[model samples]
Target: MLLEALTHTWPWYIAGPLIGLFVPLLQLVGDKQLGISGNLRHLCSALLPRRIDFLRYDWRGAGAWNLIFALGTLLGGWIGVHLLGTGEIAISPDTQASLHALGVHDLSGLVPHEIISWEGLLTVRGFVSVVAGGFLVGFGTAYAGGCTSGHAISGLSNFQLRSLFAVLGFFAGGLLATHLLLPLLF
Candidate 1:
């Protein structure tokens, strides 16, 4: 029963409140901003040893725990897939219908192999969605000063106006992608 629970999804009502609690917990424990994207800077600082202004900080002092968090995320994902995964994945009927309408036939994998594989990557649809979309995500995250998780969770918790604007922009972009760009590509 425990293993079954581990392999299954959590109800949003339960999961959402737990995730929401993280912000206050983090604030109480340490006055640190919770964001995954900022860890990249700390990593670059350690590896490059450059004299760049942004990279000049004592990354270990400030972001050692963040790096550990990143490591744990990676490890947890591996453990989940290898030790706890049930091989079958669950998707909503509406999502499956939408994908079908978009010409996706395979629903066996986490992502449609027809659109995400090496061969599929050379196709225009795959190239645009995977490569170009990835670039846009990275660029947008930097331009906004943080990722969606940061803005929606930590920044909002601290009542930052910039984060509110960033979250709105994120919603707009996602709406645009889902309603327009995604249909055009797929």
Candidate 2:
């Protein structure tokens, strides 16, 4: 059934290659760079019109397709959660044990609610993880000129040196967060 198919997780081999194919497909179709961060500038340009020189161009010409792509992503997420109702994330046993060692006892949801809820957000550890971490991610994305998906997938596929450095920084940051910061907080 359609519902069953929607609920089931696609194998990484299938999903990975499908995602990998997007770059060439996009290049063939329109020679576009696939990235969500650029869409923010387009949206701003569309809204503000002429106050800022950067926002003066016709966003519709360059970013209309991307806007539609963003809308489709939102719609797909809605359908996945609301209609398909597939919620559980399959965490590996080793990863689960590692999380348990890190004082995370709950794995009922996609994320451990004990560490991510409103009550948790009030705690020092939660505040740092949720609030500070969010700020860092946003700031880093801007500083790097794009996000992980943009750099790792699209830019890397195109052999961009900037993206290569950005991806390396991302990995280093992730390692630091997991090995050093997470233990101190939790």
Candidate 3:
């Protein structure tokens, strides 16, 4: 019964409040910002033995907890999938049809193999979607100062005006990508 419950998706009401509570809990614990992009900077600072001013900070002191959090997230995902997952992606029929129209026939896994597989990586569409999209996301995260979880959850809960603007921009960009860019790419 516990495993059955773990395998199913939680309703937004239950999940949202839990996620919302995480911000205050995080603040109470460490007073650190919740974000994933900064981990890249921390990793670079720790690994790259360069005199570059940007990567010269004491990332160990600042981001050790964040690094641990990231590790836990990865571990949690692995456990959820390997131990608790039902091995079925429950995409709506309408969504499946829409994807099929876009030539994305294989919806067996979490992501479409048409765009994420090694064979797909060699295609122009895949190249643009994966490589270029990754570059744009990294650039956007740096420019915005945080990713969605950081800005929408933590920053907004803290009542930061910058995060409000960032969240709006993120939504607009997502809409544009979904409506305008995806059809053209596919």
Candidate 4:
């Protein structure tokens, strides 16, 4: 049933809030606060050669669930890509016109060129972009103490002011990086 929902009925509207509600409920029930960035600190503590910082909590306690979540995400993405079909990434007509105005004549070819290709994935530019983006996200997640979803959906629903600030900061930082800094640097 879950797989079917993933394949069929799970639109953004349903999936979005369901996730938001689930995270805090997990926190309420399990006594573990949810945040993606916290995992970075958690992970670093577990892997560091010298151990001095961690004196309170056990990293191993979080490991199993984290691994399971990681696996689920990987599996879901693969299924979404391959089995569920790469449905058109919807954008407003106005947004499409804006891309056209920006001299992007065709916005259709912008993603997943003929599905997941090893050649594409292994290409130096692609590999570097993925690695660099992943690294930055890791750093950001650590800095923010959560991913966008954790704050935007989970924390916001719980009426957390900190999460609101984090979400805003996330958007602001992303806009700065993508709009202002990325073209200059890349």
lDDT of 3 by residue, 1-186 (tens): 977777887667988998788777888988877788878778878999399887899899988999999999999889877887846778789998998888888889777788987888999888888899888888888778888778988889889999999999999999999778989988
Candidate 1 clashing pairs, residues 3+ apart or interchain: none
Q: Report how far off residue 53 is in candidate 2 (Å).
A: 7.6
Ranking by TM-score: 3, 1, 2, 4
- Name the Cα RMSD for model 4: 4.6
Better of 2 and 4 by TM-score: 2
Among the numbered candidates, top lDDT falls to 3
Candidate 3 C-alpha error for residue 83, in Å: 0.8
Over 1-186, each residue of candidate 2 has an lDDT whose tens digit, in order, gives 976766777679878998888778878999887787767778778887667776788799988999998898899888877777755778799999998999999888656787788999988888898999978976688678788668999989879999999999999999999999999999
Candidate 1 versus truth, CA RMSD in Å, comes to 2.4
TM-score of 2: 0.81
TM-score, candidate number 1: 0.84
Error of 3 at 69 (Å): 0.9
- Tens digits of lDDT, candidate 4, 100-143: 55434445533543222355457544454567667888877766
CA lDDT of every candidate? 0.83, 0.83, 0.85, 0.65
Query: Any idea what lDDT model 3 has?
Result: 0.85
Instruction: Give per-residue lDDT, candidate 2, residue 160.
Output: 92
Between candidates 3 and 4, which one is better according to lDDT? 3
Compute each candidate's TM-score over C-alphas: 0.84, 0.81, 0.90, 0.68
The predictions' CA RMSDs to the true structure, in order, are: 2.4, 3.0, 1.8, 4.6
